[model samples]
Target chain A: MPEYTFLVVEDSPTMRQLISFALKRIPGSTIVEAGDGIDALKKLSNQKFDVILTDINMPLMDGLKLVSMVRNDPTYKDIPVIVITTEGADDARERGISLGANAYVSKPIQTQDLLNTVNEIIKSKA
Target chain B: MAKDSDSLSKKVENFLKVFKKGEEFTQELLQENEKLRYRLAQQEEVSKSSGRGEALNEQALEERLKTLEDENKSLLDRYHQVEEENKDFANRYIEVETENNNLANLYVASYQLHSTLDFNESLKIVLEIVMNLIGAEEFSIMMLDEKTNELSIVAQEGMGQDARKSIKMGSGIIGQVAKTGDAFYRDGDPTNLKGIDYTHPLVTIPLKIKEHVIGIIVIYKLLIQKTEFSNVDYELFSMLAGHAATALFSSKLYSQSERKLTTIQSFLDLLKEK
Candidate 1:
């Protein structure tokens, strides 16, 4: 089995930790945490990631901007992007998809939902 | 003349005898021909009847084959239906498993809160529970001071330094929750992060020991992604109200007892020196 690397970007340490913890449930998954989009970009430059999970609202660079940048970049364009949005943030969710995110998971996220979405994206890409 | 007449009569008698014998032979040949024709007709009728019987048997076999094909198709349709039903059951099982995992998370949070007896550790656990479980962005843990009848901020996250340090009991929403021991939730949209007045929080849960309220967990803003509270969030809030209160109270008592023990030990040491 191939090992999967995931980049989790969020401003809140608590949320970042929770997301990383949930991602760890996947077999052979390696998670890298970033405080915001800037940190995520820095990491992206250093190493290749299989999937990117980002939150919409961040301090330095928001998730939507990161998604657009990733889509524009030749190196990261093929990587699957999953945006984390608030439950009622329909506009943000649509914007994230339009910006080239592979999928979106709503906040107050259910662990199962996050897992299912990631698994689906990973299977499709495989 | 007498001799010639006798000879002629004898010759005529012989000729009539030969003619009668030839007629008998011809009648016997005709009878034999008629019997052979009747037997051939009977054989042809029997052969045609057997051919008809074979055709009837083939028609019955073809009908049987069609019925069997229809039955096979129905069985295949049922097989697909069962396959679909099995998929639905699997999905339901996953949902139940997810619920079970959520309950496990709650149990672990509760266990961690009570595992520590240090006052600061207990406070830290409460902060983590609120941040990780409730997804609060800006919030504070306030302990009620009985003497002053006011709630003071013991710990906070994402709140500005100039945030209010205390609230008088029964004064505002947070205070009212502390006074009544009932949890307070904002009426309007909880996701709107605009016009954030620190005085009015989105949720205020009163931490209590039995009937007495000890402190309150006031949340001003939730994380950007946390638009609304979930059922599990409510369960955590309820659990925190009671479990956090007990943990803090027990740790506070333990800290006081440790101080008293130190004072007594110091007194004993002085007496021994004298």
Candidate 2:
């Protein structure tokens, strides 16, 4: 099995830690943490990642804009993207999907569901 | 037989030592493989069974979600109710504190009014009560002579030079309250001073002891901070009307009797000496 690197973008330190912890359960999983979209973009420019997990609401640039940026770009466009947000509205989920998000997970997050979704997206891409 | 047993033991120890090398690694790999196979089989069974159980699981989750939402709403309502109760308690506490302070001020003012037999000192106390307790900066205390049927200013403070030193019964706002023995408060209504220059008198309280109106206290204006008078101020005015009058009258009679006793003592001594 190939070593999978995941980029976790969330403003809250606790949520970032939770995502990293869950991802660590999978063998050979590597995680990079970013506070917001701008930091995530900088990290993306520096390294290659197999998957990106992001939150919708952030300080400088939101996850929607990040998703759009990733989808528009040529080099990193193929990277699997998953959106985790407090916004559970249909329109918000639809917007994330239209912007090329592979999956949408609402907050009050179900940890098992999130892990399974991550696994599924990664396997599908593989 | 003992030699055979020792040889078997040595064989077992040697076998254990061999097992500690690369054989341990192979055992661990086999155990891990068994665990993986078990997990994979469990996953396959779950996937097959989930086709039938998915709807039931979804229904249970929906019910749980609804219960949580209702609980959250009820907790939110309880929080708002507690906040309202706290606000009401705070308002009630402020009202109770104000009433207590007002009663204390009244007691202190009553005590000051009758603390001394000196008429001048009693009068000074009344002035202090008006300025400090009542928040009035400008006012006048006047005495009504029964024989002449005239009112004269006994103690005055913060008054304009143009203010009249005396007013007849039934002449203006002050005289009307004095004539009828009724307390009058016309705050912000300056049209009632009748024929007198606008000195902006706020209220006129008739000082009465038993049915006789002894004098009147005219409040001209409050201090800068006090914009208007409250019901509590009105209650204070009524209290002063009764208590202040009795204090002044008693102090005056007491001093007069003391002077008369002194004179009698002097006359009696002179006669006894002769």
Candidate 3:
């Protein structure tokens, strides 16, 4: 089955739930939530996801470090890591690239852009 | 007459060697008679007139001759000293110029080695060249493995298999370069790089693309040289890292494109069958 599986790495439960709800509105989709990189890694070891949406700031591990860890790992390196945060700065973008993040989306994201971008990357990545 | 004869006799005694070997003795002997006659008249006048001006002229001539002789001696001494100094200077300049040429050659060679395509080949060539050029007895190029995603010694020089196998990224100078994406140097550090004696000055350059923290290039020069890692090393290693990235990216892309083309062809075949 050509189903869309998304792994959302966010520290906030409310934001996670909110994003999950919005993502569910899209057809042919399933959602998995991880609180941090460590959690994300645990889930990643078990199953593969179509996209890895991560947050910049987290307790156990931040999004940038997670992306680097993912990119460094041969198994998970190819997965696209989109950094979701309230920050948008040159340094942040440069840092994200260095850490091997695929792309970036600002926080308080509009549900429409998120859905559209997710679809596009999954489509292109596929 | 006797007084004049005695003075002339002393003059001849002083210059006996000068006249002894010379020719034309008959003409000089006739000249001496005229000089004696002049001296007889001059001495008579010296007793009569003040004769001070004539004495003064003679004294002036003697003083001038003394000064000229002293100046000639001084010039001879100076000539010898300058000759010695020029020789010393030439030797020193040759030594410095030779060293500079050697360093320039090494820099060019290192740059060429850094330009190579294969990672292991580049590392092996770089470490060996650095060891030879910089006289680093112990050397390694620890890289972050693309597959394992961990810093590992993919290629190393001047080491046994076990020694090479033990080096990992984030562990020593090489590892720190991979971890921090910056160069560091520690001379006989408080905490040494394990296994390798802390007997050399370690030069580490972070193999980074922007801030990727890819790996480290270490040049372990002798311990006593007081040579520290510089922007120069970072600049060189970073250039090598840039080349490494192109090689890596090209290989990755080539494989991916090859696979994509294969997949698309297979799909097309299925469509044709249908």
Candidate 4:
């Protein structure tokens, strides 16, 4: 798998670190942090990351808008966007998937399961 | 007949000359040798069996049986040791159960006191109860500050200023509950005095009345990693939070009612004077 930079866009600092903790458990990872969707875009403008791990609710710009923008961009269009959220209903999940998110993870995440899915998604892209 | 016997004995002697001297045991085992010839040679069958060769075999068999008996005895001793260990373990389990039951009774009594409306007094009582029940190395409650939009330590037990101040809303694991109104954990580093480590398997509960979040009730290091909060702990805390919420809300209404009662009494006196 190509070397990846996991950008965790979460407003809650605790959740940000939690997701970061789970991601860092993966071997040889480089993580980029963002407080919200706008912060994430600023980081994206500076450089490209392998996969984007975003939360649905954020200040400034929400995750749905971010996904739309990322998909529209010719340069970063192919990048897979995975939306991590607390909402588990079909409609909520369909909203994220329709917005071009490659995957969705429910809140109070299962650490090992997330890692396994992440590995598979990244490997498939290769 | 004597001549014939002498001739046969010379032939036998000549054959026996081929046998080695120390091969007596082999000669004794030979089918061709008869007791009658042995009697003529002044040896008896009874004496051969009862003498050196049989005695040596019997001695070796007894030694083998003696070692087997020793082995069996050692196994029997080990079995008794294991039985004693099992009994000790059972006794320990019973002791633990007794202690756990005692703590549970105490927990129920303490939680009953939480059914009072005065938030400050109620919280103080709750803190005292928690301190008395599960003693941690340190404990503190952080609530999200609406104005500051940060977390501040409101109540504390067994913690230093540095450890308490080391925490902030939206900064550490404790801050998650304050910010998101969701109960969560934060991993602590030994070097820094943070709220308990997230990995430490502590429990956090956000106090809510209806949909509004008031604060969180946290039990920290009630037990070490080896022991997680029991079902009793979870049930105990849940009941405590519920009672606390109802009391707090009722207290809020009671205070509000006092204000309105005074306002109405003053207005009635003004009307009487007019």
Highest lDDT, which number?
1
Model 3 lDDT tens row, A23-88: 775567899999988999999999978889988778888888888889999998888888775533
Which residue pairs in candidate 4 have backbone atoms (N, alpha carbon, C) closer than 3 angstroms, thus clashing?
A: B151-B169, B186-B197, B186-B198, B187-B197, B187-B198, B188-B197
Candidate 3 structure quality by residue, lDDT tens digits, B1-274: 2244345445545444333423234345445545655665665578458655577655655565566556555655655565565556556554543443333433454454545455445554555444433434445655577677575555555554445443455665555567777667665542233555432326666656667765555555332232343333344455555544444444445667878999999999999999
Tens digit of per-residue lDDT, candidate 2, span B82-152: 55655565565556545644554555566667677788777877776776556666689998988888888
Model 1 interface RMSD, in angstroms?
26.1
Q: TM-score of model 3's chain A, to 2 decimals? A: 0.91
Q: Could you tell me the TM-score of candidate 3?
A: 0.38
Model 2 regions lying over 4 Å from their true place? A1-126, B1-50, B189-200
Model 4: how far residue B130 lies from native, Å:
19
Give the per-residue lDDT of model 1 (tens digit) for B42-100.
54566477666555655555565566556555655655565565556556555555565
Cα error, candidate 2, residue B9 (Å): 83
Which segments of model 4 are wrong by more than 4 Å? B1-274
Q: What is the lDDT of residue B133 in candidate 1?
A: 72
Clashing residue pairs in candidate 1 are none
Q: DockQ for each candidate?
A: 0.09, 0.01, 0.01, 0.01
TM-score ranking, best first: 1, 2, 3, 4
For model 3 chain A, give the 10-residue run with minimal summed lDDT: A105-114
lDDT: worst 10-residue window of model 2 chain B: B189-198
Q: Clashing residue pairs in candidate 3, if any?
A: A85-A107, B170-B175
**Cα-based lDDT at residue B109, candidate 3:** 43
